[model samples]
Target: MSIRRRYADCRDGQIHLREAGDPANPTICFFHQTASSGVMFEKVMARLDDRYHCISLDSPGFGQSYQPGEIPDMRFVADRLMEAIDDLGISTFHACGHHTGGCAAVEMPRAYPDRLESLTLIGPVLVNEEEKAEYRKTFVRPFEAEASGEFLMTAWKYLELIGAASSVDLHCREMADHLTARDTMPMAFSAVWNQDVEGAFRSVDIPLHIMCSKDDVLWPLFERAGEMRPDAKQSIVGGSDFQPDRDPEGVAKALGEFIEGLA
Candidate 1:
């Protein structure tokens, strides 16, 4: 069964979370990417429901969540998320993140290591300042040309192409619909520009699992993550950018085995 919850009085403002499985069980929170929301994890959650209490939230300023006038940097976003976790009364939980969400997960464990049982990152973006500046100029700026209509259309088309090429599911296609290309463009660019994954990894001493798709557009990103955290275990999925979405059962099985090994 699926249940949706909204917390309007969160420290960082209002947020929406979609949940599955038993609340009393140990929790596993999934943080989605820049242009996506908790909905992308529905299928994954379904597969893991028997083993985990899964919850996925739309980050502040994305999806149904309230956006503060000022966009938060990665650190601030992590802080707000910790507060949201406290609001949920969850003392300790496993955290999994995708793309930008992985940046937040890295920061969260660094800031509050005591609250996390383990951390998992999928296709993370960990780049240096110079590379970040170049990304903004080359990719982000072009995408943000129009704040809405045309930009969103083009962005969706790009996502469709990626999904088609990767063989991702209908759920991924549907979740991609909620994102406005330009609306998230700024945040996406800023998050990558402002990330300090190496520093964050160094700050937290915890079990880390990094998963990547070999053929993904973000494959280089996972490689960067692996290089930064040399000791962390890495798992490579054989297909497309949306490996977790494309192979939910495989991803879930890998994740479960990883978590069990940690235990």
Candidate 2:
């Protein structure tokens, strides 16, 4: 099926999106990880092309979207995301998010529960102050200094190691062209640092799913998500990282099945 590329202008900046499937069907808005964009959902969207209306958005400062003069807070990002959905004339929809996007998803559902049908969080960020500090010390801080060429190169090599050459090359080139070490790195760091996962999750009461790779670096955060939403179902995908672009088919299969069961 053909995918439509669209753009929405929000208070922060222009947000790019990729859409597919039937609009008449229930919509599933996908939010991707930091440093990644809607393109990461290419495989998943293709698999779900016949089912739900799938819309993947490029958050401000990512992909083809324009960055704001100053990065907005998570609540602000969530508001703009809802605005994008409003622009599409979608009233109620499901949401799936990964990493940083997952954090935004939690905030969105909390602030506008009426707009969401359900939520699926994949490798969401850790919310508790203790867990957040640990994540920053172990994962975010170490990479802070080497987050330039080396970081991108490492990501490219990891994808290559997993035999995801096409995704790696395309996504890497996109990140290199649009993202900069000077701006995005600090912005991403601040966003995560300033995130309030506990408060956000506490405010949400919708059906929720938390999924992550068993060996993912963000597994700890996913665990925290499970703890935060004890009522939500959880799943594990093997042999993948935060994005899991290489295993999109598996991700789509699991998500589609879960969504189907929900219906």
Candidate 3:
């Protein structure tokens, strides 16, 4: 399948997207994790092929996209997505998000319940206020430049730990994104970190699928969310948190089946 690079001006900011499949088919939009861009879903979109009209949005300040004048939250990011899809003349579609992108998927459905046919979230970040506070402390904020290039090594180390699926290409992609990031990584992290994740997802009435790698750090959140929404399907794919890139076929198969079931 041919993946096309595209862009659109939204209310919040400009968004760059990678899209594939037939336009006539039901669209399945993707959202990437914090500090990461739509490229994370490239393999998944490729695997889906002509089965669905798949597109992955580069969140404001990530990838080739431009950030808003001010800081953006997950809800604001979700709104930006709505604007983009509206401009494309798409009325309704499914949404799939990984990590921070999963936060967007949850918020979008809550903000506009009727707009989504279904939702698929991979390694969602859904934690209470206390947990959020703890997560913030784990990070060395600002990620400023250092003379010793420790920041560069830090990025490499972080990506390596999270992307233990042993995919050198995946680690390289994430590392390159981190190195080129424009301080928006922290903003994106705060968006997901400080989000009212529980409340946003608890009210979702649409068909939902929560998939996570068994070895993922967010496995607990995925498990809890599944329990919270017993009606939702849960799939445990083998890999690390970067399962979408490491095992795109599994992710695509699960996502494809979920979207197909909605028909």
Computed on alpha carbons, the lDDT of every model, listed in order, comes to 0.74, 0.74, 0.82
Predicted candidate 3 versus true structure: per-residue lDDT over 128-216, tens digit per residue: 88888888876526466789988887777777777642877777888777765647777777777778888888888899899999888
Please write out the lDDT profile of model 1 over residues 125-230, one tens digit for every residue: 7777777878777555545545456855566566765563354455445435345434654765576676776688666678889898877677887888787789
Model 2, range 52-152, lDDT digits (tens) per residue? Answer: 89999987777777766656577766777778888888899989988778878888876886888888888877666766666566444333336356865
Candidate 2 matches the true fold with a TM-score of: 0.85
Residue 160 displacement (Å), model 3: 0.6
TM values, all candidates = 0.88, 0.85, 0.95
Residue 81 of model 3 has an lDDT of: 77
Error of 2 at 46 (Å): 0.5
Sort the predicted structures by TM-score, highest score first.
3, 1, 2
Clashing pairs in 3: none
> Per-residue error at 125 for model 3, in Å?
1.2
For all candidates, what are the clash counts? 0, 0, 0
Scored by Cα lDDT, where does model 1 land? 0.74
Give the distance in Å from residue 80's predicted Cα in candidate 2 to where it truly belongs.
1.6
Q: Which ten residues in a row have the lowest lDDT in candidate 3?
A: 136-145
